[model samples]
Each structure stands twice: as C-alpha cells, then as structure tokens.
Target: MEIFNHNANINFLGMRKFSVGIAILLMIASIALIAVKGLNYGLDFTGGVSLVVDFEQPVQIGEVRDALEKGGMEHAIVQSLGGTREVSIRLQPKDDPASGVANGGKVNLDRIAEDVTRTLQAARPDARLKSRDYVGSAVGEELRSDGIIAAIVVVLGIGLYLGIRFEWRFAVAAIATEAHDALVTVGIFALMQREFDLTVLASVLAVIGYSINDKVVVFDRVRELFRLARKAEPEEILNRSINNTLSRTIITALFTAITMAALYFFGGPVVHGFAITMLIGILIGTLSSIFVASPILLWLGVSKQDLMPKTKDNPELARRP
Candidate 1:
C-alpha cells in the first residue's frame, strides 16, 4: 500500500518568509507585464475566420501567411499545427466598415470568409481551404466567462476536499499553494509572451491537479505526525513531514518533468506549449508544496492541538489494523 518512502523531511520554516516574498514579487511583475503588453488571444476566443488547410508537402507558417496576403487577405494570422503539413489560418474582420461590416451594421462573417478564401487560393493555386468556421464576438465573450468559472470552481473544489479530508487550516494552506503556483505560471506566460489559449487553460488546470496531489501526500504525513508526536513543535512536525516525502516528491516531479520535456522537444507543434507549461508547473508545485505551503501553515499557527478532536474528551477512533 506504500507508494514510496524517504529518510528525512526538509525544514523550510526557517526560510518561509523569504520564499513567499520572492513569489509575491514575481507575481506583481507578471501582472504588470500582462497589463502593459496584453494577452495574444487565439482565434477561438477572439472571433476570427479559421481555415484548416492540408498541403501536399510540409509548408512553413511564413509561406502560408504570404500566400494569404497575396490572395488579398493582408492581415491574416497563419499557424501550423498537428504537423507542418497542416496549417490554421485566421482572419479578423477588416476595420474598414465599408468592407467587413454589414449593410445594416451587423458583423458580416460570410463576406469575410469569402474574401479570405479567395485571397488564399489566389496566392497558392495548389493550396485548398479544407474547412472554415467563425465565432462572433458574443460567442467569444461566453468562452471567456466559462473559462474563468471553471478555474474558480476547480480551486474551490480543491479547498473543500482538503478541508474535509484533513483540517480547515491544511486546506487553507493547500489552496494558497495552488494560488501561488497559478500566479507564478501566469506570470511566466505573460513575461515570456507565451500563447494563452484553451489548451493553455487545460494545462493550468492539470498543473493545479498535479500540484495539489503532491501537497495532499505531504499533508497526510503531517497530520499523522501531529497525532503521534503530540509534543513536537509545529515546525518540527512540518519539517519531518516534508523531509520524509522529499525523495518521493523529487522522483515523481523529475520523472514527470522528463517526460514533459521529451514531449516538448519531440512531440511536434501540437504539444510543444502544453508540455513546456506542464513542466514548469510540476517543478513549481513541488517546491511550493514543501517550502511555501507547509511553512506558511506554521506562520498561520497550525499545530497538533488545532487538528485534535474535542468532544468533551473525545474518543479516538480504533485503528482497523
């Protein structure tokens, strides 16, 4: 039934303040960068005409963009996905009201598609527009709302589950850790100008799930130590718990990171961003679960007595073993 074992727990309580300060500073930087540069949202959430084209041979993104431009779609976005042979084309409505806007002032999707396709075809005779779709601005707004709701629900669910499983304080610590990791990840994306799309959103969720799983493992040990070593100080118990789980955490995180790195390097365009983001998340999650979250619990005054059951001298549940 044992997943893994380790020799000692690392004492991070001594450095908790410094670690948290650095994380907060980085988060601030990330927010500033996002505000200044803005996010480069994808077509799915930005309302654009999407064209999927499969070429007879591998084609570069530059070539596709050039083709679309020559065909008269001068401001289209071209990206390759799945493989270099497959390309995704996106065209925003021209700002000029006379051409893109409707006769009645409604958004004109049909005309945009028609003009984009014509331009693409004219630029490359052999290039065929495999499929096309469009999302109105109203639809994009809906997607943004849904994505935010999903993230909030996930964090709240993790907090509730942890509170029930351990104690409210442990749950609080875990959620703070999750927030830390999320903010750090977003900051990196903002600073590096990484694409934040639906897939990236999925990756962020995955990171939260993975990071919390690690925290739960460590927290379980801390709770057990709390019950057994009733006289031990909170810092001692936390240090022991983290040290005991250190090896397992490192092994699992490094293993996951290695696999993610391999996917990033060799998995082609489809997985490059996802793998990179996951790799960063796992490493951050592991570090924060130990150095950041557990230590903060100490600062917040979490201790063995806080978790002890009290029902006017409560009875201890008998161990089945």
Candidate 2:
C-alpha cells in the first residue's frame, strides 16, 4: 500500500523555493504573534490551585467549566478523571504568581477552594471536594526553566548526533527543519492562546523526535542516491531521492495522524493539547524534510564526496573540474 507509485517522478525539489517562501511567511507571522500575544502558560508554569472533586452523579464537563468561568476562574483546565464522576481542575493563580514564588504575601487557599467548590455546586449540587494542592510561584518558575532547557538540549543533541553520523551540512539542515516545526507549533499555541503545560511540553519534545525520524528517512535516501546518481546534478538527485521516499513518508504521516486524531476525539480533554501539537508537528515536519531540509543541502553545496569521504580523488569531483 504505497501512497505514491515506485515509478513516480514528482519534482519535489523543483517546488522547494515556493514551499520555503510559504514557511518563511508562516515563521514571520508566528514570531509576531508570539511577541505580541505570548503563550498562555498553564499552572505548570504559573502558580495555581489543583482541585480534585467527586460528584454524586456523572456530570457534563462543559457546565462545570462554565461554572468556573462564571466564578472568575476563566480558562480553567477541567477534565473528568478515568471516565468516572471524579474531576480534576487546575485554577490559574489569581494574583500573578507566575514566577512560582510566594513573594511575601498570598491568597487564602481555603477561601479560594471554597469559592470554587460553591461555583461547581451550582452546576452539580453534590460536588464534594476531595483534595486541594497549591502550587507556588517558585515551583512554576523551576518547571518553566527546566522545560526550556530540555527543549534546547534535545535540539543540540540532535545536531551533534547528526553531525557525527552524517556531515555538518546535513546536521545543520536537520536542525533547521526541527526549528521550523517547533516554531510553527509554538506559534500556533500563542496565536490560539492555548494552555502550555507539562503535557504540551512533552508533546514538543515528541515532535522533535518525530521530525528527525522523517528527515533521516529522506537523508538516508539522499545518501543512497548519491552513490548511484553520480552524474546527476544536486537538484536532480534530491528530486529522485524525495520521489522515491515520498510514499513511505506519506504512509507514516497518515497512520500517525489517524492515531492522533483518535486521541484528540476520544482521549478526553486532558490530552487534547498534546494531540493537537503532535498533529501539527507531524504535518510540518514531513513537508519540511523535502522543502526546507533538502533545499538547505543545495545551499550548502553538499556532494557525493561529502556522503562518502573514504574514497579519495572522487570521480564526481574529478568530472566537475
């Protein structure tokens, strides 16, 4: 079941410039929105209250959320726990404790909890509070810093690994591709004002790994073609490589999308952010491998010699001169 035929002759490289242009415009828009609107950091990065409650009966998650909004906790994260009557809610800190630090003063946690409980009781008369946890501003700051560090480390590790396995040009191209996927994903979150939490952060890391896998598939094909298409121009060789692997790329992305779509629909609200990030990343990463990464190779002037350095006085180089 190949999405593209074995004998396909799609000139993927020929469309690189147009694709890159579109990516550039997207990057610019994403950056601007990020600067202006910024991300909606969740309780994971901002001090907040985590509440678990048990209701006497199964209730609509939507009405519970609406009650929270009416109670002045706008955009609160609420989800049913394990298909049961239990629900967990994270109420964003009311006093700007985004730094996760107590800062010498605090809101009365008990009062806040009472107010939230009463609000939900209006929706479901039998709401019973099970437990409440207060995350300080300091904790949010640490989590936020750690999440940023993790993302940087993953990107650098990929660059180093690719550099050692392939060439620096390919490594750089891979890094650029990762950046393209990451930025677009982040931009979407900012533009939509979605909550950025631990789960969403994990999704970002997952997207980085997934994007690399797609790039490696194309890079592997390019290296194989370099040895056989020795007389072909870089663009022609790249076009051949991408066309050959196009089927595999599409199939992989298609199946992955199916899985994520199911999660988005059935996995409940708790995993919604995670599913959305992955869906966008997979699509961006697949296209970036062909348009963004391959075009970078062309700019770097990568040749057969770069792929196979063991052979001295390469025939391709000899023929070039």
Candidate 3:
C-alpha cells in the first residue's frame, strides 16, 4: 500500500521557508479576494421566491433555464425536483423589480409568484405552477449569521480538542491550517462568483473537518516519532513523520478527490456547490498538511520534550532509540 519507500527521507522541512512564504501569500490573496469580490449569496441567503412548476411532458433543465432567462429571470436557480416533468425554480427577490417591493419595502411574494407562473406558461402552454414559497430577507440574514457562528464554533472546538489531545503548538498549527483551508476554499467561490448557499456553507464546514483530520494524522505521527527518536531535533522528527505518512495522505486525497469529481459531474446542480468546495478543499488541505501545518509546528518550537510522557512509571520515555 506504500507509494513511497518505507524508509524514505525527502527533507520536506528543508523548504519550510519557501513553503511558508507561499502559504502566507496565498492566504493573503484569499482574504483580499473575499473582501473585494465578496460571495455570491444564493437564494437561501438573499431571500427569494421558490416555485415548483409541472409540465405536461418531460423537459430539459436547460430549456427551462433558458425560458426563465429570456423572461428576465437570468439569475434564477433551476433544478429538477424529481422527474423531468417537475422542476424547481428559485429567484432572488430582486430579480423582478416590478414584483420585488410592495408599498412599505416588503417583498411582494404573491406578485412574484404570479409573474413566474405567467412567464412559464408563455413558454410552455401546459406548464402549471405546482407550489410557491418565499424566503424572507430577515430569515436569510439570520441563517447567514448562524452559519458564521457555527463555523467559528467548529474551529474553536477543534482547537480545544487538539490542545488537549496533543499540545498548544499542535492546536495553534491546526487552527491556522484550518483557517487557511476555509479562506482559500471560500475565496475561490467568491472569485468565481459561484452561488453561496446553505449546501455550500455545509461543504465549507465539511472541508474544515476533513482538513483537520488530515493534519491530526500527521500530528499523531509527529508525536509518536518525537517520543521514539532518542535525540532527534524537532525538524528532523517532523520531516520523518511526514515522509512516513506521505503515502497514506496522498492515497486518501487521491481517492477522495476522485469521488468528489464524480459527484460534481453526476450529482447535478443541486450539489454542485458542495462538490466543488470539497474538491478545492481537498487539494488545499492536502498541500497544507505537508507544507503549512508542519512548518508552523516547527516555528512554534515543538520538540520531543513536549511529547515526552511525564509519567515516572514509563521508563521507556527515557530509553535511547
């Protein structure tokens, strides 16, 4: 199962300065992109009208999307509900200015629904409105706030767990790595102006979890090697640990990326945001585990003593390798 030699020595930490510089630059760029371009919040966050339309016969999603676009609903989010005959359409509240705001700045949901139905009927004579719903701006705002809180909580929770499981150095490195992965993942979305919705938010959180898992594996190896190597320096121990686990990390990321690619191509637009986010996160996370986390741990002065067992009963802790 090993893709690399069992006793490989690649000197990964030799390029620590270069890798760390690249990581810092990328993270800075990600932040800049997010701050400037901002995310293209989807129907779930921007508050919009949801419509379910039924046609007399099976129709292509592209055809429905085109019809809506021609009717001035270019930003509509269209997807198949179940079969080809049933389609779901989501439009931001601002799509139709005539029906967007009522007397006192309230969304005119009824008018928007009627307008959508009329537009669809014009395109297909038998197109019928199956259901209509509205997501208010207030609700979307609340969801956005809640999603931010959830992400912060998850990151903090991970830092706490790692602090307890390993040490403060590992915790700090893990936190930085996770933050880098999340920002880069989200930044790509903002750069591409991809729809940021509930599903995508979920994917970002999933990426944090996945990225940390990879780092923890490496961190675990580092601690083991530190304790086992009799007089190894922190850099030497980290390099050995990463090289030892290189095969596993690459293999895992390869298969996971392949699965995500399949999901992206076949899982339809409903899961596009999730699939794409996972794909980006995987690439960034894999690289960061090798280049980012270990370097940060080294810079934080992680040493054998930090991992050495303090128990007097364990004489092995003082034994030579």
Candidate 4:
C-alpha cells in the first residue's frame, strides 16, 4: 500500500519559495482569465430553448449542427442523448423585432420548437420532436445568482469549520487553498470556452470537499508532530508531516484521477463537464495541498503553542512535550 517510504525525508518545505511563486502566478492568471473571457454558461444558466429530437436513422452530431446553422439557428449546442439516433439541441433565446418582440421579450417556446423541428426535418425528413423545454432569461438569472450564493456559502462554511477545528491560521490557509483550486478549475473552463453547467458547478463543490479532506489529513499530521516533537522547529514539523502523508496524497489523487479519466472517456457527453472538471480539480487540489496549504500555514506563523492543548491549571502537563 505504501508507494513511498514511510521514513522518506523529502524536503518539500525546502522548495516553498518556488512552489508558492508558481501557485500565486497560477491564481493570478486564473483570476484574469475569469474576469476577461468569462465562463461559457450552458442551457441551465443562460435562457435557452432545448429540444430532444429523434430521427428514424442515426445522425452524426456535426451534420445536425451544420443543418441547424444552415437553417439560421447559429450558435446551437448539440449533443447526442445516449444513442446516435437521438440528439439534444440548445439555442439561446432570440428576438424578433419585426414581430414587435423586444430584446428581452418573452420567449415563444412553441414557435421556437416548431422552427427547430422544421429545420431538422429539412435535413432528416423523419426527425420528430420528442420533448421541448424552455428556460426563461429571468429564471436563468435567478439560478445563476443562486449558484453564486451557494458557492459563497460553502466557502464560508468551510472556513468556519476549519477555524473551530484548528485555529485562524489553519482556517485562513484552507480557505485560500480551496479558493485557489476552485478559481483555477473554473477559470480553465472559461479560458477554454467550455460549457459551464450545473454538473460542472457540482463538480467544483466536490473539489472543495476533496481538497479540504487532503488538507485536514496533512494538518492533522502536523498537529500530531508538533505535539510529539520536544524541540523541533515549526518548519521541520511541517516538512515531516507532509513527507509522512505524501504517499497517501499521491496515491489517492492518482486513483481518483484515473476514475475521472475513465468517466471522461466512457461516460459520454452527458457527464463530460463533470468528468473534466473533476480531473482538473484532482490535479490542482493535490498539488495545492502539497505546495500551497502548508506554506501558507508556515507564513501565518502557526506554532506549537497554537496547536498545543490549553493546560493552564496543570503546568507539568503543559511542559511535558
């Protein structure tokens, strides 16, 4: 089970300057990317018309997209739904000034559905509309706002928990690490112009949980080492703690990344956003735990006194370690 020596003496903290520099650069780049390019919000976020169509024969996704584009439905998002014969099409709401429809006018779901059906029928005569749904711009706006609120709540909740479990230093370090992992993961989607949907958001939340779990493991080790080492410096204790848990962290991330890779390859387009987000998250989260979290803790001046149990009434016990 041990992929590395339990007694391994890797000087992880020795490279703190370089690693922290890289982490800070990545975080800055991620922030810039998000602010500039922005995320490619999917159907769930942007008000859109979605149609599930079934053709008598299997159809290539590219051909369907081409047909839609040729039919004046440009910027359509198309994907296969389980099989080649069925596909889902999503399109942003359009305005019809000629028909007196304003830019943010109510979307006519039935009319949009009819247009999509007609367009597809021209390419595939037997194309039949199976289902149609519409997300209003107002609704999408609310969902978007709610998603942001949820993320903020989760981050705050995590900070609160960490603050109580350890101390302000550990809490701040964890919050910063989690935020880094999230921004980098989400910023990649924005940079690549990938679809950011509900599934992807959920994966980001999962990444927070995963990243915090790793930090907790290492922090626990640090605390234990701090209590056990009589006169060891904080840096030495941190280095030993990270080294002791290095094997576990790498092994866990490896297998989890493998699982996410399989999902990305075999789980189909339905879960592509989720799978890919987790994959990116796993890589970033693992690296941040090793390089980012502990260094921040050290910089915050975490010491044995912060972690040592209060024994004011028992001077002998307090001085034992």
Candidate 5:
C-alpha cells in the first residue's frame, strides 16, 4: 500500500518563489481576462421567460435550436434535459414592459408565454407546454448580490477557522491559496465565456470546500513534523511534510479526477458546466495545497516558536504544583 517506502527529500520549499511567481502571473492574467471578456451570465442572473416543453417524440437538441432560430428567437437559451424529448427554453420577452414600466402598464407575462409557444409550434406541432415561468431582472439582480455575499462569507469563515485552529501565519497562507484557487477557476470560466449559472455557483462553493480540506491535511502534517523534529529547519520540515503525504495526495487526486472525468463526459449539458468547473477546481485545489499554501509559511517567517507558543507559568499555579 506504500508507494514511497522511504521519506522523500524533494526540495518543494526550495522552489517556493518560482511556484508563487507563476501563481501570481496566472492570477493577474485571469483577472485581466475576466475584466475584458467577462463571464457569460445565464438566465439565472438575467431576467427571462422559461418554458418546459415536452415533444411527442424524442427530438435532437439541434432540431430544437434550429426551430428557435427560425422563429426569430435566435438569442433563446434552449437546454435539453438529458437525452429525452424534454427541453427548457429561456428568452427575454419581445415587448418588455419593464423597460418603460413607469410610462406603461404591467408586464404581460402570459403574452410572452403565448409568443414562445407559438414560435415553437411550427416546428413541433405535437409539443406540449408543461410549465411556464418568468424571472424578473430585479429578482436576478438580487440573486447575484446574494451569491457574492455568500462567497465572501465563506472566505471570511475559512480565515477565522484557520486562525483559531493554527496560527495567524497559517491562516493567511491558507486564505491566499483559497483565493488563488477560486480566482483561477472563475478565470477559466470567463476565458471560455461559459454560461455562469446557479449550478456553476454551487460548483465554486464545492471547490472552496475541497481546497480547504486538502490544505488542512498538509498543514496538519506540517504542524505534526514541527513537534516531532524540533531540530529540523522550517524548509526541511515543509519538504518532509509534503513528500510524506505525496502518495496519499496523488492517489486521492487520481481517483477523484477519474470520477469527475466520467461525469463531465456523461453527465449531459445541464450538469456539464458543473462538472467542468469541478474538474478545474480539483486540479487547482491540489496544486495550491502543495505549492501555494505551504510555501507561504516560509515567506511569513514561521519558526518553531510560532508553531509552539511559549506557555506562560502562573506563579500561584506553580506554587501549588
């Protein structure tokens, strides 16, 4: 069950600057890409009409898309749920009263639904409208705001947890890698202009959880080595800690990657985006745990004294002992 029988002497800490530099460059590029290209926010973040249409027979998604295009709904979002004949479509209303609500009357939600039904009628005559819904722009905005707040809360919570469990230096290092993992993942989405939806947001949260767990494992080992090898330098302890956990890390990552690969290829388009983000998150999470977080301790001047806080002896308690 052991891949590395002897303790590894790999100089992981020696290359801290190189790895940290690369991470910084990648993060900078990612921020630039996101600023310029931006993410493709899906209907979840933008107001739109949604229709759950079920066809008489199994129809190819391509045919459904073509019908939408020909019906003057080229900008419509059509997603097939699995390989079945069910497909959901979300599109902005043609005559949106929200644009001039102050001067106009109430929004005709039913009217928009009728128009979508009519548009798809020509191509699939036997199609049945199972459900109809509308998401207002205001509602989408609220959801977006809430998502951002939730993410911030998660990051702050992680920092607090690490600080209490370990030391301030360890806390900062963990947070740095956590931020790096998130930004890099978001950057990939922005670079590809992939539709950023609620599920994708969920994936981001999942990534944070996975990344933190991995970092804690390595950090815990580092702390353990600090106690055991009192004479060992910080650099040597870091290398030993990472190398000792190398086999476990690799094996765990490999198994998880295999599962994610299967989900990405076979999970269908609805969950495809989620799987892709998860895969990216897993890879980045592993890298950051090893390179980004642990190396930061070295830069922060973490010594054996910091790891083991000096215990102050109370005069009264000492007299009793």
Candidate 6:
C-alpha cells in the first residue's frame, strides 16, 4: 500500500526555516527556566518518609494532615491515592544534626518512621499503616547516579545501533531526536515544579525509548526515499519521505495519546504521573521526528548520493549537476 496517497502532506518543508526559529526560542526558554526554578526532586532522590495507609472509611487529606500535626508531625506531605481510601504520606527530615544519623553517622530512616508511626497511631486509631519505605541520603545518591548512567547508555546504544544499521548520519539523527524529546520533557518538569522521583525517572527512560522508535521509523523512510529519488534535492527528498510516512506517524501518535489519556484519568495515582509525562513525550516525539529532527538532517546536507556508493561513471545523468 502507498502511504503517501493520503496527502497527509503538511508542506512542513515550506515552513522549515520558521520551525527552526521556534525550536531555538523554546530551547533557550527551557534552559533559562531549568537554571532558575530548578526541578522538584522528590524523596526518592532525597531522604524522606513514605507511608501508605489504608482506612476503614473514605479518608480526607485535611484530617490526615491535622492528625499528623497533632501527633507532632507537622509539615508532612499527604495526598490521597487511587481515590480517597488510600493515602500516602511523606515527612520532611528534622533539621537537627543528630535527628537522622545513628552509629557511624548513617541515616536511620526506619527508626524515624517507627517513631512517627507510633505517634500517628496514638493520634488517629483509624489510620492503619499498610506499607512503608525510606531512602537514606547515601542510597538516594546512588540511585540518582544510576539513573543518569542508564539514560546515557540508552542514548549511546541507539546511536551505535542505528549507525551500524544505516549510517552515522542516521544514527546521529536518531540520538539527536532522543535528546530533543528528553530536554523538552525535563524542561516541562522543571517549569512546572513537578516532583522528580523514581517514577519520573522511569517515565524519562520510557520516553527516550519511545522517541527513538518514532525517529528511526522516519529516518528509515528518509533513507529509502534517498535511494528512490537519487536526483532530487535533499530538501525535496526529505519532504517526500516525511509526506510518505506522515499518515503512519499521525495514526500511531493518536492511538498512543488515546491510551495514555485513559491511564491519566483512570490508572490511579500509582501511575497517573507517569502516564501524563508519557503522553506529553509522545506528542513531542512525533512533532520532533517530523519538524525538528528531519529539518536538521536536511540542513546537514544529507543526500541519497552519500549513502549509496557510485556504480556508474554516468551517475551524473541521474542527478542534477
């Protein structure tokens, strides 16, 4: 089946110059916001208490906060989970130097949680602690480092794989697209001050993987079109490639957005944030594959003649000289 027949042709090539300007402006703004406001890193990266509590009746967040305060646990973060029946609480560590550390100056989060739980039980008999987790500062630092390493590895792996399968240009294009998606996603998190946590890290990785999949699809098609239209200018060939795969790209993006929207609305608190981030990434990834990444490749002077070695001395006959 011919994918180009739908005329999903957006004439994006015509507006390519303007798209670059817009992307540059956005990138600058994103960088400035990141530097100024910073991300809202959660307890998963910084030491804090996380407790999941179940109650016999529907829970009210205000009442929980009040109860904790009454028990001398003021300034605790409390939010209802799933609905109003399950709730999670995070308590900030005490500022006192010795409150958290035990022997050898290691954080004793379990002890802190134990004390807090006992205090809460005495204040609110209805609150039943279902589960608890604590991340010490040392442990959180390790996890943060590991997450960064994983993201780097993923980007490099994609570059290497695509380079081997296609060409260095294609590989670079794919990795650039991945970085484009990640920076935009991270910029949004920083701008909005969303909690950066383990779940957020997972979503970032997922977005990287998803963005590359879309980019590689477009790059593969571009490579094919380069071969088919050996005489065409790079811009014309890229436009043709994008036009050809435009239908598939839009359909895939729409379907993914629909699924993610459902999860955002009904997937529960456990995954709601992750789903929202993925949804945003999907839209950005699709747009970047078409506008940002492809335009960069064109600007870089990619041509069909580069990928395929010369077979005939009269190859000039097949292309404009």
User: How many backbone overlaps does candidate 1 show?
Assistant: 6
C-alpha lDDT values of all predictions: 0.78, 0.85, 0.89, 0.88, 0.82, 0.78
Q: Candidate 6: TM-score? A: 0.76
TM-score of each: 0.78, 0.84, 0.87, 0.82, 0.82, 0.76
- Could you give candidate 2's per-residue lDDT for residues 52-134 as a string of tens digits? 98998887787788889887888788978886689889876555453232565566678778888888888779999999988
RMSD value for candidate 5: 4.3
Deviation of model 1 at 30, angstroms: 2.9
Number of colliding residue pairs in each model:
6, 6, 0, 0, 0, 0
Strongest candidate by lDDT: 3
Residue runs of model 5 more than 4 Å from their true location after superposition: 2-6, 54-88, 92-115, 118-124, 309-321
What's model 1's lDDT at 134? 71
Model 2 score (lDDT): 0.85
lDDT of 1 by residue, 1-321 (tens): 124456544457778888888777867776787788766665557776777887777777777777666766775667777797788877766667755564536556667666666765565556666887776777777887898788788988999998898888888888888888887787788778776777777898999999999999998888888989949798888888888888788888988999998998887555676898898899789889878888778878888877777654644544323
Candidate 4 global TM-score: 0.82
lDDT (Cα) of model 4 = 0.88
Error of 6 at 222 (Å): 1.2
Listed per candidate, the RMSD to the true structure in angstroms reads: 4.9, 5.3, 3.8, 4.3, 4.3, 6.4
Off by over 4 Å in 6: 1-5, 50-91, 94-134, 309-321
* Model 2 worst lDDT run, 10 consecutive residues: 93-102
lDDT of 3 by residue, 34-127 (tens): 8999988988898878889999999888888888888888888888987989999998766335875645466787888887888888888889
RMSD of 2: 5.3
